[model samples]
Target: MAEWEDGFWSSKDGLRLHYRDYPAKAGSTRPPIICLPGLTRNARDFAPLADRLAGDWRLIVVELRGRGDSERAKDPLSYVPVTYLEDVTALIAEAGLDRFVLFGTSLGGILSMLISATMPGRVAGLLLNDIGPAIDPAGLVRIRGYVGRGGSYPTWLHAARSLAEVHAVAYPDYTLDDWLGMAKRLYRLTPAGRIVADYDSAIAEPFKVPGNESAGDLWPLAEALKPIPALLVRGGLSDIVSAGTADRMQAELPLLERVDLPRIGHAPTLFEPECEAAIDRLLARVGRAG
Candidate 1:
């Protein structure tokens, strides 16, 4: 098992955020990997993947504000992507990272594009997990239905079962143990012994605003990764990233590497063999290969 260090950095607005930093194997010089999790997700979501990749490259899995052990935003509106971009930038500076490969899932993927656009060439490579330039409305609607609905469970098993009911569609193959593992990542056991969602319900406020779902043209942001080595991983059963949108992204970024997981929906766990291979290929393309 790889050893990891706990990290904390102050956001621009003074919130103390957290991240887990896993070092590369002894004497290795591979470029570091900074992972960003999906909306409503925290750094724990990347633990399994980070453990697998840490031997090849340093991995920093960040807990976006209001998630995990991080401080909640003073203003709920601060949960927006633009604000997240600022926080990510601060993290990069705090970590003294001049360059790194980005592994982003969903909302994290969107942030990767925005960051690349603003700081072109800083991202050595990108791995976008189940997100595209164009988001489907149906997916947003489905997400809105459950994103902010926080609940408390009497036991971890109950919480796991409840979560499985909501996300089983995305991981139809997951077993009871898999659901339990996922529950641990997505929920926290409170001091009162109740298991609750890890992220702030307030984080969902922006999505509720009128026209916020389709507010911006992300294609421009997506294009920012065009010159950098990139990989796009999509779930074939995904509602968030349709096959058509993924095709269009490939057409737009001619260099983009792609992997489509037929059994998953919304996103594929980055620990999968295919995803790991894709990451290796992207790293090679960007000259970060071991």
Candidate 2:
């Protein structure tokens, strides 16, 4: 693991979001890469990649609000992507990075697309990991199922098992310990010794307010990001990003480079050799494509 250190980012609402610092090699002038974790995930998700990328670029992994060490919002409604988008912009400025690259996964991608469109100049390039404009209702529901639910498991091991039971199909490469680590990262130990979900569950409640309605029409967001150097890394077996959507994205934005990772779904964890290779290729392209 990278030498992890704590970071705090104050949102406009006065909420201080938590983050981890992964410093790159000395004298490394590579443009910073801001990593955005998936729903209910934290900075730990990027440790594997952050360690590898240390020689090339600095990685700022954010915990977002209500996830990791970040404080939970009293109002769950404050947990939506809009809140996160604002937090991201604040962190970028706080980091003194007027512009940087974005490596966004799942929810992070949604936030990235929003930011790239809203604050185009701040984004040098975008790395979308295993997500796209079109998402399946089934995948969204499955993700929502666990977003803020703190299940009654006596031990963390049980929670890990619960995750394995639910997500094993999507992440076959993860061992039980890996699943346990994932569970641990996603949940914090409460004073009562029970697992309370780390993220603000209320952030996801809006999606449930209306049946079958997406958080918003993200396609317009994608379309608005025209001519920006972008790489959409899709998993071949991903149910969330249908093949048609990927094709449509390519058609709409010819500059968007699409790479499909075989034997993966929803998202690639970015720990595998194949995934790493794809990212390396993207990095080279990003540096030159600009």
Candidate 3:
């Protein structure tokens, strides 16, 4: 049940944003699920999940700026989540979609929550893969180290191998090719011909700068999805979104249902039968209303 899914458009900044969609190919029944990938991820990562769910709800995955086949921004500051929301709004309009479901993971989840708050009317429902309002500082530091690292990897194999270790909690079984595909989507071949990461290197500017002392809070955004049907899926061992926070989220918004996958961390890849079935239930619950 892991397999198929494209909608490609140029952003206002002139970077091509690659979106892979299942569309309403034959079933003209419902709007599609807009798949928002994680940081350093591309649309292709959703291929397996998209193909598996095509028989039910349609799936559309977007390659965010500086990731996947999408072009990197000239202004590194543009890589922020706020910029991402505007870009997604553009894509939604370009797709000719008035309203649709949002399936977001990690960074994508953050954007989904924000968009749900800013453009509630546009999102039919919000599917959060493995993220929440409170993020673990330890995990943020880990991510910062890699995203902020410099220099080219000797080869894709080396890069992939390194990720498998660093991401062992989230991607324990990822194959060499899986890692390679990941590397491809997150980086592009530089003009000098070497494979540099798919970002303006400068994109990490704000993130690297000295901390603006404020406890980050996304509950406002998460709570905004309250009226709209929503589902939160978390990995059991995830450092990013712990069970404690997920529980608190459920309590705050009783309407927002929650589930946790065992033995995974950061995010679940969403290819397992249990995970798939759980998602289908959530989508059906929301999609059936419209």
Candidate 4:
């Protein structure tokens, strides 16, 4: 396994957040990748992918506020993307990083666009996994149903089984070991030996409010990445990003490269061969290769 160290930085709002920093091979000069996970996901979501790339380039996987080891916001309303962008900027400053590539999944992908828009030249490259300017309403509805629904299980096996029941559609070929790995990524064991979702249930408050999901189109923010090296990875079975939207995105940003994982849904785990190949191409565009 690739080695990594725990890192912490404070958000502008004084929230202490956590991240995992994996160093590159000695003397390697490739630009680092700052991974941002999906809503309700944390740094652990990138473990498999990070380990795969750590030998060639540095990796910094962050746990957004209210998720994983990061401090939970006292106010559930603080879970919005704007605050997340602020926290990311703070991370850049605290980490003393000049420029880095971005690897974001779902909500993290949305944040990548916004951050790129705000600071165009600072992002050397962008990889948006299973998200785009347009999000399918059906997927939003499905995700909303479970994002904040927390549960406790008697053992790790039970937690893994529960997770598989909820997400089996996305990974039909997943074996027991696969489900077990996913359980570790999404849940944590408490001192009392109860296994529960790692994120704060309050993180779902924004989805409950009216008009929040369709506030506006993200195309404008995504447009900011036009001048930078970028790639979009979509799950062939994903409902979050429809074929129509992906087609339109390519039309708008002709320079944007793309990949589709046929067996995955909602999101493509970056560990997939196709996703990894696309990432290599994206990094090569920025003069970094694995």
lDDT of 3: 0.76
Please list the residue runs of candidate 2 whose C-alpha ends up more than 4 Å from where it truly belongs after superposition: 172-174, 189-196
Assess every candidate by TM-score. 0.95, 0.89, 0.85, 0.95
Candidate 4: deviation at residue 180, Å?
1.5
Please give, for residues 176-256, the per-residue lDDT of candidate 2 as tens digits: 888887777766677888875666666666666654346556888876667677788888878688889889988887667
| Residue pairs in candidate 1 whose N, alpha carbon or C atoms collide under 3 angstroms | none
lDDT of 4 at 260: 81
lDDT of the candidates, in the order given: 0.87, 0.79, 0.76, 0.88
Q: What is the lDDT of residue 94 in candidate 3?
A: 84
Give the TM-score (vs. native) of candidate 2.
0.89
Model 2 — which ten-residue stretch has the worst lDDT? 207-216
lDDT of candidate 4 over 24-57, digit per residue (tens): 9899877789999999898889999888889788
lDDT of 3 by residue, 14-52 (tens): 888777767555756677788998877777667778767
lDDT of 1 by residue, 15-51 (tens): 9999999988888766789999999999889988877
- Residue 70, candidate 2: alpha-carbon lDDT: 84
Better of 3 and 4 by TM-score: 4
Best-to-worst order by TM-score is 4, 1, 2, 3
The full ranking of all candidates by lDDT, starting with the best, is: 4, 1, 2, 3
